[model samples]
Every structure is written in structure tokens, then in C-alpha cells.
Target: MAQLSTEVYWHSTEPTEVGPPLDGDASCDVCIVGAGYTGLWAAHFLKQAEPGMSVRVVEAKFAGEGASGMNAGFVQMTAGKVLRRMLWYYGAEKAGGVYRAVARSILEIGRFCRQNGIDAQYENTGILQVATDTKQLARLELQIKRAQRAGVTSFRLLDREQAQERIGSPTVLGALKVSGALLNPYRLVRGLARVVQEQGVLLHEQTPAQTIEKVDGKWRITTPHGTITANEVIVATEAMQGAFPELYARQMPVWNYLLVTEPLTDEQLGRVPWPGREGVANSLSFSTAARLTADNRVLWAGGLWYMFGNRDTDPRHRRNDDAFDKLGASFREFFPQWRDVRFSHGNGGLISWSHSFIPQFGRTDSGMVYGHGYTGSGIAASHTGGKILRDLVLRRKTEFTELAFVTVNQPKFLPAPFGDKGGEFFIWRQRVGDRLPLLLPYKSALAPNRFFARRTGSPERATAGRSSD
Candidate 1:
């Protein structure tokens, strides 16, 4: 195996062109913090809506340097890990609307890429969520039923034989197939940044917003080299939101790891039956997902999720030798035929999670518009979030604004030591859940439930949700 490459596969493959940081003081009609998908999309739509409005995006690092570039690249529609919970929480009608909106956003992303002539290696190969055990199979079946009840007809369940025909994973007992796409995430974000800049949106890289305050009714954002005063500010920093005291208790950041295999030769690729190259993820609490790159490399990710107290954002968190070893081991178990496959790169990034396991969109009394907490699924949903942020900043009560994600009041997470302990316990439960039958004797269902109830603000049961790719 090649030595582990700590850099994200998507970014290391195609580095983005970045501009200088904010110079001196500047003012704009609207300013966005963080140049990831949420920020880029907000800038893109805002500029498109009001061409004359002065819009600016400030980033701590280069665009896509965050989770936007490090994610698994599965452009999916299902917002989080579960659809049943969404239906139960928001009702069938509202849940169906959210699902439809995300589905449309997936298509819109593809359309936008095509219209802008961005070759992000986008492929509508769809998503295949496999179940490796009987327990997981039951969960998959339940999800199918819930989706149907919610009027979501796009997902279809497949048996072992059918799933094997699609992916050739011997451990797959069943699979849930859904319409989605795969793309080179780094290229997509880089392309969007270029397009938005061309539309006259001022994008300043390496300009970290150190402090945000209100001065004379306008929002003032202070950066190391300069300051920006804007009529409105959208905080799209995702996991980094923990840095702000106001948003600290709203999300907990967790690290997710990924590994990419060396490009498979034709004969080696032929050993697997993934003609469609669908994004595949097993139904584990900490799910293992695999996607084929444009160069035929297998991007295998997930399995180990780590969270340190205080929501650490250190880049050193990206290098986890043990996590990489676990990922490689799981890949071999899933595809023994590819046992000889060598990995070319390995990396990890932080993903934010709300107690509700849903994305939150709302404005603060201080007049800041924010949308975040995609859990582990934001590639496509973040596009929808862009629309929500746009509507919120413009103070428009449109369809996007009325969606449950926007209209509903998201529950806050437990504060401090309690939250940290809850997260540690949650991770333990997920690990046990993955080992299921083999570890049944050591598992305590009620203890985890009670612990979560005490630690989480929401009364709803805590479900295992994945971080977005």
C-alpha cells in the first residue's frame, strides 16, 4: 500500500485557484462567512437574484478547503440517515415536501454544472444503500415503507441477489436504491467559486472573520487584514459554528475518515459488478460508503467517527492511522476480491450535528442569517439551504422559507461536559450497533436511551446520522 496521504483526495487531485485575502476595510450589501458549498451557493443565488447588490464571501482558508472538499462526494437527496424520523417529526406532508425539494436540488446542481461548463465528473449513477445483516435489512425495509407513506416513491428496495448484481458486495443482504448523483466535490466548489466571482461577487480567501458585531444597525465582520460592513451576514461556516458562543450549543463537530484506493486496472475493476458506479453505503450507525472516482479509484470512507470535547478544528485531526487501518480492513471484508487493492490517499474532516439530526435555518435577533447542521448529508441539501438562506436574508416568505427546516424551531444540544459525555456515549453506542449480534451481550439499549434523553434537549429518540460527503 502507498503511504497514507493526509490531504483530501478530491482537493489533492485538483487544487483550486484562490484569491488574496480581504484588504483593508470594505462594505457590501451582503457578506457571507465561509466559502464552502453553503456560502458559495448563497453568493451564487444572491448575485443571480440581485445583480446590482454588492455581495462578498470571506473565507478563513481557500474555498472548498473545509468539508466541502473533503467529503465523500455522494450528491444525495435524503437529508439525513433516516426518513421515518423526518416524517414522524414534521408530518408526512412536510417531510414529503422537504424530500422533493432536496431531489430537485440534486437535479439543479447537475444543471448548474452543465450550464457553467464545469466538468466535475458528475454522474447520475444513483445511491445504493446496502444492508449487510438481517438487522440492517429490517431497517432498510422500514425506511422503504416510511418513504412510501411519505409519498416518496423514488426509493426502491432490492434483495440480496439484485443488490449483488449492482455492486457485487457479498455481505449485502439487501439494498435501498435511490436517485442521486456522484461528482468530484472539489471541482464542483472550485467551479462554483469561479462562476460566482465572474458574476461580480467579491470572494476573499484567507480572510478569517475573527469577530462579528453590529455597528449602527449594520453587521460588521472583522478579519485579520480588514473589516467588512454589510447590511446582512450569512454564517455558513458549518462545523466551525462551534467557535461562536451564540451557536456553540447548536452543533457538535465529529471527524469522519476516508481512504481512496489506487486506480484499478480494467481486469481488476471487472471483478466487481458496479457497472452503474452507484455510491454504496452500508446500513451501519457509522456507515461504510464507497464511490468510484473518474479514474476508477475506489473512495472508501466511514466506519470510525471521532469527536473531541470543545469541538476541536485542528488539521491534525485529519490524520488517524488507526481509522485508516480500520477502513482498509472493512474494505477487504466487503470486497475480498479486491483484497490486493492498494490505497493512494487517506483523510478526514469535521461534520456538524444538531440534536435533531437535521439542518437548521433561521435568523438571530442580532440579524444574522444562518443555515447548518446537515449531520453527514449536505452536498445536495446545502443547495436547498442556499435558497433558504437567500430567502431569510432577503426577508422573503417564499416556499423555501416555509419549509419545515426553516419554519421549525430546532432543539438545542446539551451544553459543556454533559454534551461531550453524550457524544462519547453516542459514539460507543454506534460502535456497538455496528457489531450488533456479535456484541449483543455487551450492549445496553436502555442506558444509552436514558443517557441521550438527559443529554439532548429534544424529546425525540436519538438516531444514528451520518456526516455529509
Candidate 2:
């Protein structure tokens, strides 16, 4: 067995190119902080909308160095339970709109990859939300009903035998095959940065925005390399948003980990025989997902881990031995045929989780535009987010800006030690709930929906307006 390497495997898929940092004070039409998927996509759409407009993106490190390169490469539509949470907080119309928008983004990403000639290893193999037990199967059925009610027609149910035919997981009781795709996120993000740069967008690597403020009716961003002033500023930092005091309360960073097996031999591959190679994710809040790499390795990830500090993104948090152990056990249980297989890599990344369990998009109180908090799923949503941010920045009243997630009054996590404690407790309770069948009745209590609903009265009351204002 090979010793598991901590490096993110996707970054090794291709050569990384880093642009020069900002030289001195500069000005632009728009300045976007954090050059990950959200920031890069926003810049792409902004330039697409107004080709002549000057846009500059400032990154603390290289573009895609953050979650963009480290994520599980799932271009999924139903991220962070947005479908169910949107339906619970907003009406079916708004929820359906959000779903449809993301679904379109997934397809568009594939098209964008093909058109741009980026060999991100894009595959249109849809994902499978599998259930391992009766309880999880019931949850899948409920989600199917909710999806139907929301006018989503892409979900197709597969029985145990049918699901096993695709995944060969003995533990899979059933699954919901949904429209999605998978790709090398590092390649996609780097490709996005390159494409945006080609379109005359200045990408300044190693330029961290230290402070942002309003001056003379314009936004001024102070960075390590130089200061950048722009007519508009976009805070697209995502999980790293907590680093900024101005945006800390809006989101929190939770560390999640995964492991990847060494490339399987022809005999090992024959044992599984996954022809479609669809992404497989379980129906748990702290769920696990597995996918096949283009190199024939099995990447298994998912199992949420939150540190005491909501903003913690230290390099040390990238490796959680206990989580990796749990993942290995779960993988063995799922695919007993591959019980002896060894993981060659095991690493983790932080995801920006919103208090509402849905993404937050719109302008902030300080008059700057922002979008983040995709929970764990963001590859496809970030593409849609870019278009939404474009509309918001351009002051367009398009359907993208009218979605429920584009509101100003998004719910916030509790402040300080309390919020940290609450998060720890939530994880503990969920882990306990997964084990004890007796705790099934109190499972809904784990979500903040009931509390928010009672306080706000109705969906309309909770989310007041369609406009960002």
C-alpha cells in the first residue's frame, strides 16, 4: 500500500501558469477579489456583457489555488440542498427558477469547455444520489416528490439492481439519477482565468485585497502589491470571505476531506465495471461522494468537519486522519470487491457554508456586490452566479437577479463562540443521529429551517424582495 499523499491530485493534471502581480496603484471599471471560480466566472461574464469595460481580478495566491482547484469536481445543480431549502423558505416558483438556472449552467460549462478547447476532461455523465438503507431511501423518495413539485423533470429513480449496475455498490439501496457532469476543476478554473485574460481582463496573482472601502463615490481596494480603485468591487472570495471583517458574519468556512485511490489495474477495474462512470453521492447531510478520475483512480470524498473558529483555513486543517479513516471504511463497505485497494492521496478543502444552507448573492450594505456560500457544491452554481453577478453589477432586472437567493436580508450565523459551539453541536448531533434509529423523529431539529420559519412567519416575510435593494 502506498502512503497517501496530501497534495491535491487535480493540480498535478496539468501545468499551472501564474500571472504577474499588480505593480502599483491602478484603476479599473470593476475589481473582483479572489480569482477562484466565482471571481473568474464573474469576470468572464462581465467582459462578455461589455467587452470594452476594464475588469481586474486580484488573487491572494494564483487563480484556482483555493477551493476552485481543491473541490470534488462535481458540476451539479442541486448544491447545498438549495432545491429543498429554497422550496422550504421561498415558493416553488422561485425554487424551480433557481434549479433551472443551475441546470442550464451545468450544460453551459460543458459547452464552454468544448468551445474554448480546454482539455478539462469534461464528461456529461449524470450524477446518482444513492441510498444505502431504508431510511436514506425514504429521504430520496421525499426529495423526488419535492423535485417533482418544483417542476424539475430531470430526476429519474433507479432501483437497487439498476443502481448497482452502474456503480456496483452493494450498499446502494436505490438512487436518483440527475443531470450533472464532472470535470477537472483545476483545469476548468485555470482555463477560465486564461479565457478571461484573453478577453482583456487583467488577472493579478499574489495580490491580496487587505482592505476595501468607499472613497470619492468609488470603491478602493488596498492590496499587498498595490492599491486598485474601481467603479465597482465584487467580493467573490467564497470560503475565504470570513477573512474580511466586513463579510465575516455572512458566511463560515467548514473543512471537508476526501481520499483518492491509486490507479486501478485492468483486473481491479473489471471488478467494478462502471461503464457510465457517473458520480455517486449518498443521501446524508454529512454525505460521501465517489467519482472515477480520468487516470482510473477512485476519488472518494465527503464527511463534514468544522473547526472552532468559523474562519479557520489553515494548511494544517487540510488533513484529517479520522475523517480519512471513516471514508476508507465507508468505501470498503460500499465496494467490498475493492476492499484491499489503497488510497494514494488524501486531502481536504474548505467550503463556504451559509446560515440558510443556500448561497447568498446580491449587494452588501456598503454598496459592494458579493456572492458566496455554496455550502459544498459550487462548480456549476458558480457559473450561474457569475451571470447573476453580471446582471447585479450592470443593474439589470433579469430573471437571474430576481431569484430568492439574490436577496439582501440573508440569514446569518450566530456571532463568535456561540456560533462555533452550535456548529460543533450540529455535527455531533448529526453523526449521532445517523447511528441511532431512535433519533429519527428529532432529525428535522438539526436544520435551522423551523426556527427561521417561526421567526419570519412566511417565505415572503423571510425573503422580502426580488430586487437586491
Q: Return the lDDT, model 1, position 408.
A: 71
Task: Flag regions of model 1 displaced more than 4 Å.
Answer: 438-469
Candidate 1 TM-score to native = 0.92
Candidate 2 lDDT (Cα, whole model)? Answer: 0.82
List pairs with backbone clashes in candidate 1.
Answer: 72-469, 376-466, 376-467, 376-468, 377-468
Off by over 4 Å in 2: 79-82, 438-469
Worst 10 residues of 2 by lDDT: 460-469
